[model samples]
Target: MTAIVARPVSVKLDQETRGRIDRLATSRRRTTHWLMREAIQQYIEREEKLEAYRQNGIAAWEAYQASGLHVTQEEADAWLAKLEAGEDVEPPACHV
Candidate 1:
């Protein structure tokens, strides 16, 4: 295991927003800093997943444009349904 080095960061907020965060933090018995850090962590994770999905879509599009090979919607649905029923099965083969 490795130790993590913590660094200080500064963020500016409006008076009303600061007050709102302070009230929530007091009620939850947590520091405003903790809430802000958690919110940032979650936002980053979600955005990373979205970016990966976008890249995968771009790759799949390029592959289809090059090879003109794919499975039909019905074939894909059937293969997915088999898996949903807890059966171990391979995916449908791609075709031109």
Candidate 2:
């Protein structure tokens, strides 16, 4: 058995949506609050992914600048073109 913490929240729904929620809850033997919590959890997970991507982009740009390598838009395009052409460019050697 697992212990769960629950909170009380107030939400307003129109008559039609309220009726639908009641029917679904009755059919599935679930409370509307459980469904809402699951929906919110999924939304939070997606937003977290976007936040991670933003952080990774910022980190990569800062690393590039710290490396003292001058990178231009033309060089970026050329690298992309090489990548698109399936050229085997060796990975940058890292100094530990």
Best candidate according to TM-score: 1
Best by lDDT: 1
TM-score of each: 0.80, 0.52
lDDT of 1 by residue, 1-96 (tens): 999999999999999999999999899999999988988999999999999999999999999999999999999999999999999999999999
Lowest summed lDDT across 10 adjacent residues in model 1 is found at: 31-40
- Least accurate 10 contiguous residues by lDDT in model 2: 87-96
- Candidate 2, 24: how far from true, in Å? 5.7
Model 2 regions lying over 4 Å from their true place:
1-4, 13-30, 68-96
lDDT of candidate model 1 versus the reference: 0.96
